[model samples]
Target chain A: MLTKRIIPCLDIKDGRTVKGINFVDLRDAGDPVELAEIYAKSGADELVFLDITATEQKRKTLAEMVRSVAEKVNIPFTVGGGISSIEDVDILLKNGADKVSVNSSAVKRPELINELSAKFGSQCITVAIDAKQVNGEWLVHLVGGKVPTDINLFQWAKEVEERGAGEILFTSMNNDGTKAGFANEALAVLSSELKIPIIASGGAGKIQHFTDVFLKGKADAALAASVFHFKEIEIKDLKEELRRNGVEVRL
Target chain B: MKIVIIDYGAGNIQSIKFAIKRLGFDAVLSSDAQEIKAADRVIFPGVGEAGSAMKMLKSTGLDKVIPELKQPVLGICLGMQLMCRHSEEGDTEGLGIFHADVVKFKTQLKVPQIGWNRIFNLKSELFEGIKEQEFVYLVHSYYVPECAETIASTEYGVEYTTAIQKDNFYGVQFHPEKSSDAGEKILENFLSSPSLLK
Candidate 1:
């Protein structure tokens, strides 16, 4: 059986990853190559580098950033943001990204997911959904969670599965910046309905949240950032707690 | 002496480099014939479409240089597969170092058996310090069926050759770089093995 994954996403902006309240660990953590090697050593199951600093010029720089990280870590990695076409997926994957995650573009044109999944295998495609609660319902959000979509979270997840997405990376926007815990309620519903592996993202204040998502929410993996970036939670200790919680993890 | 890693243009080489450094060995990435011929050992690693990989190997002229290496040569994952007779991936033809075809694992468990699995039927010096039924991590959809050159065998939905050995050429279906202690010993064994150096 495939063990649960613990992914630490790095948000890269102009060759540097930004995390507030700068410290020594994070000061050098800004270097993509160094940070990727650190996480790989820290028992990170996988990694994600989101190109949040989207601009017409930043695309090539992002590719270089990806190459730099790729040089350091051999584990599977996913790159997202500013990707809008099959070529973007190809160039990135060719340059060493294992998978290309599409979010805003998928909402604007869902067909891109199917197209890329067709050329490449479904295993190479990851569809990232940003969702938030609105009046007791989790509604899908788009473009860094600024705009709301009429599509229901459950329906959209199922649709992505049908669209040939190998994995659904669900990020709870309400919990994105808060870091309280994962939205297990939303995760439970989506995990049960979808056949592909689900990566639960957003709201991880401590390592227990990862255990909760894997055990309760049925997520195949738990993804976090700030806790790892700021050295608030060391990845080895986190995996230890997950093991103690009876979640099958690779440590 | 610089160790040459044949870049037949398949997968990432960082893991291999990291693995070698951790084991206290120097590895150089190269596809050039002269550099590879001058090295003490040659490692061929690949990870993508097999036919295309072989095509790239041929295009870079590494296909000719690899099999003729006088130094100990090791292949990892898709590297081993490409060294075999044929592969089901991309309906590709492979280098005929080993007389076996890489077939897709029966789709009983999953298309890709992407986790750690046990390796049994151990043979040869590669298993010198390693015990039988020891677990080795694997992440592959296609595997070479058990053959004469098989040194280690593992079962997912069915038993398949996990590692193969022939003369100076050795191939491992599992990623030794990613397999921890057992993998390190196997790598060190390759580096320390005296017979392959001839």
Candidate 2:
């Protein structure tokens, strides 16, 4: 059976992890490579490193970080943020990153998705869509969910899949920091409408929320940042809980 | 022993090299037939459109050198699919080492079938220490159905060949380089098992 994946997302700035990580045993919490190794050892199915670094050296730093992480971590990991061109993805993958996620860049130039997938294969190209529901319409947002577009979330996701995106990382802007719960309704709709795998992002507060995301949202994978970083939800216990709920997870 | 990963400009060979490095063995990435043939073990890796990847191999003449090599050769993901007789993807013909055809998943489950899945009924020395139903990461739309060469099988919508072996050649549908510790164990078995030597 194909198990549902649980992913821990880490924010990277200038090749260093952003935000406070609460892992007590971590010698250097800001070290993305060390953190990634710990997460892999702790039963994380996959990891996503979102490079929030914005600078001329961002590309080189992110690539270096990816190489170091690849050397230390055993599980698959995806690198995202500020990846707007083929050269960026080429360098990252050359340095040993398994997958690369493209967000605002893909929305800005939809052909970018087609180009990346054609060159690298859809299996490694993940199109991330940041969206929020407004007046019953799920609109696609850009620049980390700060700007909104008239594009419908479903419509954009369909286009992305058509453009050869291997998977869709749908982040719900409204439910992101709330931790109330995932946007299950929207996720279920996307899962049904798209042939590619849908990774539910944003809202994830408790173990039940993770369960609901898989059961209710019909998500192929669930990605969270703070919950796992803060130790509010341990990955081992979370997987055990998910298994108890009848959700197949790699234990 | 010298290990060479055949690099025909297909996909991410870095991860495989790093994985081997972690196992305390260094691997060189080369498209040169001489280097590949001279190595004790060869890793044929691909991660793009089959047609394009096949073209790259053919250009480097690796298509011919691979099947003729006597060393233990391992293929991963697209590399495994390319070992078959044919693939539905891009209507491309394969290296014809596995005696099977790669076809796309027609089930309602999903197209790519990404994430961790179990490999059961292990019958090869390649999975020496790996247990049955052990999870390995996979991401692919097409798969080779159960055939005479099948050593392991995985179920998505239908039971398909996830690992196959024929003579000195071994192929796995999953990415052992990315499958964590269990996967690393499989790689180690492939590299160190003297029984696998021809």
Candidate 3:
């Protein structure tokens, strides 16, 4: 049976974790690798290390930090941010990341997803959709939800999945930092539509948010950044709670 | 001792090398027969289609050399598939090192069974500290059915072989390098302990 995954995302800037309020103000969380090890020990289904600023100075430290994380833990970890080329995806996957989460770069070059999927297979490529609710409809946002694409979230998701995206990581920019809960309606709509696994990101405040995403949104995985990063809601405890709530957990 | 990974032009060799380096051991990427024969261990890792991989393997005569390898050999994913008797991907004949045939999962779920799945039925030294039904990351379209050499089994739509062991050859349907710590521990065990028969 396919178990639902709980992922903790870390926005790494210059080899350190920096959590921003709505992807704006960057504050150093801690060492990226150390934090990943903590999450791995805590029973995180997977870890996503987004070099949030990989374009600027974050490039140099990306491989080094990934190497450190690979050394410490033995779980599937994904690294995104500033991954523009197939080589970038190759380098990160080579650096111990199980999947490459492509956001901005992929939005710019949709062919990159098809190319990478062809070379590495869909299981290796994940298209992360950062969407913001605009005019009551989910609008796809790029450049960390700063720039809104004319493309609708559902349409784009369907296209990417057709192009062989193994999984979809959908984040709601509106409730990202709000931590109220996930955009269950949007996730449910997308999850039911795509045959591929859908990962609900953003707006994960408490343990029930994970349940809501799984049970209500029908997501295969739920991604939380601040909640898990801040250590407010431990991953292991959250999984147990979900299991009690009728979700199949590893433990 | 350095491990040589055979690059049959079908795999994520760079990642496998990175994985070996993470294990604190040096691994060299090579397709050359001489390099493979000289290495402490030979790693056959493949990611592409089976028939294409077989063509690439035969092109260098590595197919003949791989089966004759006296040193320990490990095949990952399609590399593992190639070690079997036959692969249904392209109706390609395998190296026949293991008495098994790789066939696609016939369930209505999907073609490629991607994501992580728990492994059980461990019967070999491949699993040292690893408990039964441990979750191992698996991404494969086809699987090698029940065989005498199956070391570990995983349940997907039905029970399938996750890892298999024969005399000097070992194959894992799941990517040990990609599976994480528990997966790495198994690799470390392989690097340390030789087959009991040897």
Per-model TM-score (chain A alone): 0.96, 0.99, 0.92
**Tens-digit lDDT track of model 3 for B1-198:** 768989776655666776677788988889888989888788899876788789989998998999998878889998999999999888999999999998988775534666577888888787888988787777777899877888888877778888998888999988887677788888877776665323
TM-score of chain B of each: 0.95, 0.99, 0.95
True contacts kept of 1: 0.07
TM-score of each: 0.78, 0.99, 0.89
Model 2 agreement with the true structure over B1-198: per-residue lDDT tens digits:
899999889899999999999999999988888999899999988898999999988887888999999999999999999999999999999999999999999999988999999999999988988889999999999999999999999999999999999999999999999999988999999998999776
lDDT of 2 by residue, A177-214 (tens): 99888999999999999999999999999999999999
Candidate 2: where is the Cα deviation over 4 Å?
A: none
Interface RMSD values for all candidates: 4.0, 0.7, 2.8
Candidate 3 C-alpha error for residue A177, in Å: 1.6
lDDT tens string, model 1, B125-188?
Answer: 8778898876565667788998899999987667888999888888999877756567778888
For candidate 3, list the clashing residue pairs, or say none.
A74-B180, A74-B181, A75-B180
For model 3, the DockQ equals 0.43
lDDT of 2 at A90: 98
Model 2 alpha-carbon miss at residue A190, Å: 0.5
Alpha-carbon error at A15 in model 3, in Å? 2.7
* Candidate 3 wrong stretches, greater than 4 Å: A20-29, A54-58, B9-11, B14-24, B90-93, B106-112
The TM-score measured for candidate 1 stands at 0.78
Per-residue lDDT value at A69 in model 2? 95
